[model samples]
Target: MKIKRVSEFVSIKRTVENGTDEQLLAVKAIIGNVKKDGDSAIRIYTQQFDGASLESFTVTVDEMAEAYGDIDKEMVLIMQEAAENIRSYHQKQLRSSWMTTEENGTILGQKITPLDSVGVYVPGGTAAYPSSVLMNVIPAKVAGVERIVMVTPPNQNGKIPAAVLVAAHLAGVKEIYKIGGAQAIAALAYGTETIRPVDKITGPGNIFVALAKREVYGDVDIDMIAGPSEIAILADDTARANEVAADLLSQAEHDERASSVLVTTSESLAQKVAAEVAKQLAELPRKDIAVKAIADFGAIYLARDMNEAVKAVNELAPEHLEVITENPMELLGKIKHAGAIFIGRFSSEPVGDYFAGTNHVLPTNGTARFSSPLSVEDFQKKSSIIMYSEAALKENGAKIATFAREEGLEAHARAVEERLK
Candidate 1:
């Protein structure tokens, strides 16, 4: 990893901006073809990309039952525990439709309603993230989404991972489809003969999947165009360099594009953490990927003081932030942006990713400045409720009519005028 003085590295940009027009055009072609040709387009793309010839895309009911039997008992228990924690966390976010009446006989409020159906796409290739299933589906279930559909790639043997199946079952997914990549996104957005279109699609996948989601966003809602996993550590001399190095490597191992950065006030601590990262990297199974990530996107910066380090972190706005200092809480008031903040040495990124009872699907690539982690709100829609009594209309209708007329909308003015009469 490269080490630089904080003053010099403070203005670093994380990832490149969004994709170019050519990339968007390719995604658009895929979406349009899927919308036009339906299942035939899906089959062609699936065979071309996933190396699997599917006689059918949707998983059979019996297959789901078989998955449960195939999975290990111990793994099943772990998934159950994770599901319960995820459910408990999201249950607090559940909202109900409500209304309030005034003495003037006007009722004004908002109604919360879950979407009819949602689609979740899980990446399948080198790994299967059962945790992702819990993160995506539990929030939808909590929001009362009627039907939750899942899409994942099948292995060359045409079998989904047992853990993936078990996680889907625990999260209350209604259907699972053996499909992946842009084609799977197309199938979800447009719906094939076997697959029904969903109101929204959630979860993460590759660049093709991200581009597909970006392409199909207007047709169906998506959680966000997640870029890559990232973690930033803000530490002081008080922090243990070994622990900080390990935490950074945890995110670095995610992918070659993932970023792991460290900003500290003490130059000595920076040097120690750099040595620790090199030592830990040798032992990591995914060391090559982590090394590339650290080489390209990761860094250790020597800030002049804690405030400078905090400023650099806020500018980076990493998906995960770890503050390990003598007084971690003291910096919390200074932090204006971050997807999730991990305070103290023990509160590492993985804790929040797994069992911390907080959603791990976070904003990436500086999006934490405005976007939020996936939650129950992503699955539910809100509608404004407005009811005015005759007297109330008489009181406010003129203002409404005047405002509408000022905007040169005659129909709007007439509607209010007739109501008043």
Candidate 2:
């Protein structure tokens, strides 16, 4: 890998913004079919894409119990601990309703209510992360969502991974279906025969899944249209090249499309890191993928100084940003756009990805500039409550009517005018 100017490293467009008409048309057809045919459509798509024909989509209690037994009991215990951490972190984000009474006796407040049901999509076909199951389900559970249904593509054997099933069980998700892709999204957004519709859907998938979420957004609320995983490391002279290389590979191994970038003020450190990345890439099991990702999207930058480095961090707005320096926390206030910031050498990216209490589901691409990570709020809605008193309305009626009249909204003015006279 070569070091480039930080300005040149940014992806030109939103990753989600670009999609071939053919792909979109194909996804649209899948969504339409699932909406029309329901469970039958899901079964057919599973057979065609996953190479598995399923008579039933729902994962039965027997299957879940078998899954728990199949996975290592030690791993299950660790997942339980991770679930507890995720739950504890998200419980703090739970909101409550409150009301206030003014001197005029007008009541105003905002009411918080959790969504009735939510669907979570876990990708299949060589993509599986038990950590994702914990991250996605626990937040919804903490938000008091009544139902958390999970959908995942089945392998050719027509089975979801045992780790995934075990993680879901520990996270308190009882409803899981063996379906995936655009059809599963349609089933979630618009109900099917066996699978009930959900108020919202959250989780990651391939491009088709992201597009499906984009298409079905209005029908059902979605968390975000996430893209490939990305990590940006802003390191100074004190940063270790080997440690930096390891962290970059952590995200790069995620997929060939994933992006890993380093912005450093030390030119020597940049060269050493690029070399260390090459050295370490040889040892990784996902070396082929990490190599392609590093070759295609990964970058190392030679920033003139820390100030210039901060500009690059804010520009890319990566899903994960690690600041490794003498005083990493000192740069926290200056950085503005990363989804999650990892400070110091010990606080590597994977720490947050799996074990850290922070939600791993983060805004990808440049969406971190505007969007946020998955949280309890994603599973809840707020309603504004306004109770107008007679005295308050009488005091402000003409003013409200005059304001409406100024905008040429005659009916709106009349609606308020009726109370004035």
How much is 274 displaced in model 2, in angstroms? 1.2
Model 1 pairs in collision: none
lDDT of 1 by residue, 278-393 (tens): 99999999989999999988899888888889999999998999999999999999998899999998898888898777899999888899999999999999999998899998
Model 2, C-alpha of 182: deviation from truth (Å): 1.0
Q: Candidate 1 regions off by >4 Å? A: 11-26
Query: For this target, which candidate reaches the highest TM-score against the unseen true structure?
Result: 2
Error of 2 at 148 (Å): 1.1
Q: Give one digit per residue, the lDDT tens place, for model 2 in 74-169.
A: 998888888888888898888899999999999999999999999999988666689989999999989999999999999999888999999998
Per-candidate TM vs. native?
0.95, 0.96
| Number of clashes recorded per candidate | 0, 0
What C-alpha lDDT do the candidate models reach, one value each? 0.89, 0.89
Q: C-alpha displacement of 336 in model 2, angstroms?
A: 0.7
lDDT value, residue 241 of candidate 2: 95
